[model samples]
Target: MLHVIVVLAGLCTMGMAMPLPDFYSYSPEAGGGTGVMYSTAHEGHITGIRIWEYASAYIGGIQLRYDGNWTDLVCVNSGTPMEMLLVEDEFIVQVSGKHDSGYIFELMFVTNHGRSFKVGQPSGTSFHLFPTHDGSELRFLSGRHNGWGITSIAAHWAVYSSDNSVTP
Candidate 1:
């Protein structure tokens, strides 16, 4: 009985030393692999958040957050970014520039979605919903001038609230 007890204790100690498996029943030698912490977001599928700023058509559309930050995105333009409703799987942003004409627009995604855009057309143009290339935080610029502080209500209604209701 003493020998059996000793063996049991030894087994328990060894088990304690070994790392436990994770949610995936992970084992380094399992062959298939432990997989990654965050799945690579499919570039085409635009979920979460997205922002795009326009610049003379030359700056094109800058997608914020994993897309990019406003400071880094439309830095030179100093435009107003307004959050538009998410239609069909995208978060739209309307960025209007204040500068007379000094284009510094950044074309959307460098990898597979960038080139150039229409020049000098950002003042009253509404760009499309920005796409997310990575799986991190997302940001977009907004213009809340509201034509008379009235567009605020419309802007709220356009965005999807955390509770899943259209914001009022």
Candidate 2:
């Protein structure tokens, strides 16, 4: 029993020594129209998202693509700072904005055990997504509702695998 305890202790230390991968990276886009949809190259649990809005007051909300169709996560016009909505059995984290871009810095995905992981971004900027695709996609508000422009977008997530399990 003493030997087993020692082994387990070593294993736990090894896991702690390893570090999580960087999910999101700074990517800039310009001259894009509003309501432009973007997809990730890989599938993973979305931890958080970061945005840079050009116009503060004119900034609009975001449209998320989950399951099949697009769903409005949040609209700044609603007059709310943040909202958690249930979509197709999955919970979406929506942040509101008004005269500010409402920057979200390092949104972490918490586990059932209270452990948190930093999410990663998609493979590239131009990745496409189909309706049948199981992965989540983000549609930025550009030139919409007073011509609010998204200066930059970064998605944080972890690699999704069938064997991998997560808390709801």
Candidate 3:
């Protein structure tokens, strides 16, 4: 029994030493049919984001900058574009949006520094995404985007390890 207790304690300590990613559920897929799936799972920390949106319409496209490299834009760039750059240690803490049966109408990214990037129109069902674990920030994004707009979306959060590796 003592040996088993020691093993369990060791396991608990190991678990505490390594942080894990907190995965929130995906938001509702507003558009019908499965669109092309994309994931921004790269090796560096997120340093910026670009969003393209049609005024009073929907989110048309999105791009993320990881460290110094930018991911390929998902969907089409058919509207006004906005960009947000993060300073060192800044991170996204929340993602709220609105979507309807046909498109994601709005998106807003809130950061730890109290800054936010908001776009698109405000019409449809609402969604708010955030990490449940403290110190975790937006690490990446995964979702399906139709050729026109984002049909579904999800955020991945993690407390980045000291070497900038995503934990878990």
lDDT score for residue 74 of model 3 = 88
User: Alpha-carbon error at 25 in model 2, in Å?
Assistant: 6.6
lDDT (10s digit) by residue, model 2, range 72-165: 4433333233322233323222212212232222222223233433322221223211112223122222222222333233333322224333
Query: Candidate 2 local accuracy as lDDT?
Result: 0.31
TM-score of each: 0.19, 0.23, 0.79
Which tens-of-lDDT digit does each residue in 1-168 have in candidate 3?
A: 999999999877656533432523233333433589978776677899999987678888999998889998888888778999999989899889888876778889999999999888888888898877766788778888878888877887777666665455
Q: TM-score-based ranking, best first?
A: 3, 2, 1
Candidates' C-alpha lDDT: 0.27, 0.31, 0.78
- C-alpha RMSD (angstroms) for model 1: 18.4
User: Where is the poorest 10-residue window by lDDT in model 3?
Assistant: 23-32
TM-score-superior candidate, 1 or 2: 2
Candidate 3 has which clashing residue pairs, if any? none
Q: What lDDT does model 1 reach?
A: 0.27
**Candidate 1's TM-score:** 0.19
State the lDDT at 95 in candidate 3. 89
